[model samples]
Target: MGTTLHPLNPSDANLIQARLSELGYYRYQPEGIWGLVSRSALQDFKAANGLSADDVWDGSVEASLRQARPTPASDTPFGEWSVVGFACSAEMNPRKMVVSAKGIVVGSMICDMQGPLARSSADWSGSVLCHIDGRDIASKISLRVSGQRLVDRSVIGTSTIVPTSFDRCS
Candidate 1:
C-alpha cells in the first residue's frame, strides 16, 4: 500500500501557529484557525525569505519555516496545574488552556498551554467553576451558549457555586 497523506485539521492550526509565532512572525495566540493574522504572518515570513507574496503555501514555504527558530515568549508556565491541556470548544476562537477539573473536559486536549485569555477550574470542593476566554469575560458576568452558537450561561470570576454543565467545554 502507498503512504497516505492527511489534510490539515482544526488541531493543526495551533501547531503551525506555534511554529510561526516561535519564528517571531505570528503575533497572536495560537487559536486553531487560520485567520487574517496567521495569513499576515505567513506573508511576512514569505516576504522576508524572498518568496513571492501569494496565498498558495507550496513546498518552499514549508521548507523555510521548518528551518526557522522559535521565540522566547511562546509560553509561560501554568503553576500547580499538573493536568492535561485544553482548547476552547468555540469553533471560531479556540483558546488554549492547562486545566484541572472535577469531571469530563470537552474539546481537544492541547499540550503545554496556559491561556491568559481565560481560566476555567473547579474552585470549590466538588464544585466545578468554569472560566472561559477572559477577553470579554471581565465585563460580562455570564454567557448563554446555545446550539453550538456559543457556550451559554457561563459565570466566571465570581463565587457562583455551580456544576460543570455551566461550562461549555468542561
Candidate 2:
C-alpha cells in the first residue's frame, strides 16, 4: 500500500483516528490515512493489547474494530448535526442511476417543511433534494449521511428515508 497505510473503509479511519486521540495520542490527525501518528498510536495500542506491536490491525485489529464500533449495526438517527447523501438506482443495473443527491444539509428547526419542500424557496430546506433524478421510478435507493462531515457515515435504511425531508425542517 506504498507508504500510504489504509483502513478497511475510509469511514473507519476517522473512527480510528478519533479513538486514538481520545486515548491521549496527541498527534493523531483524523485525515483518513494511517500515517506516522497513526502508526505510533497503533503500535502503542498493540503493545497495550498484548499483540506483536507491529502496528497492524491483524486479528486483534479486527476484534478492536468490532469492539470500537458504537453499535452492532448502523442505525443512528439522522441528526441535524450531519450532511446527507441520497441516490437512486436500478437493482438490475447498478450503473444506471435515476436520481442522485449530495451535500444536502438538514433543515433548520425554524423553517417549515412545506417551505423547503416547495421548489421556489431560496433557503436550503427544499433546495437540497430538489435535483432528484427520477421522481417516478421505483428503484433501489442508496442513501447515507455523515454525522461529522463524513467521519461517521450513517447509512440510511429503507425505513428511514422519509417521503420528504421537508417535514423534518421544523
Please report the candidate that would top lDDT against the real structure.
1
Question: How do the residues 1-170 of candidate 2 rate in per-residue lDDT, one tens digit apiece?
Answer: 32232465567677777776654432446877666656656654543333454566665564653454422111211222212333222133322221111222222212111111111112112222221332322222223322222222112322334433211110
How well is each residue in 1-170 modelled by candidate 1, as lDDT tens digits? Answer: 12121114457667767877776566667887877767656654554454654444667667666663421221211111111233444353334222221121223422211211232321111223333442322221222222222222333445442422222232
Q: Considering only N, C-alpha and C atoms within 3 Å, which residue pairs clash in candidate 1?
A: 22-70, 22-71, 117-134, 120-131, 143-153, 144-152, 144-153, 145-150, 145-151, 145-152
Error of 2 at 9 (Å): 4.2
- Evaluated at residue 157, the lDDT of candidate 2 is 24
Number of backbone collisions per candidate, in order? Answer: 10, 2
Alpha-carbon lDDT, every model: 0.39, 0.35
Task: Please list the residue runs of candidate 2 whose C-alpha ends up more than 4 Å from where it truly belongs after superposition.
Answer: 1-9, 65-170
Best by TM-score: 1
Clashing pairs in 2: 113-166, 116-126
lDDT of 1 at 157: 41
Candidate 2: Cα lDDT at 105: 25
Give the local distance difference test score of model 1: 0.39
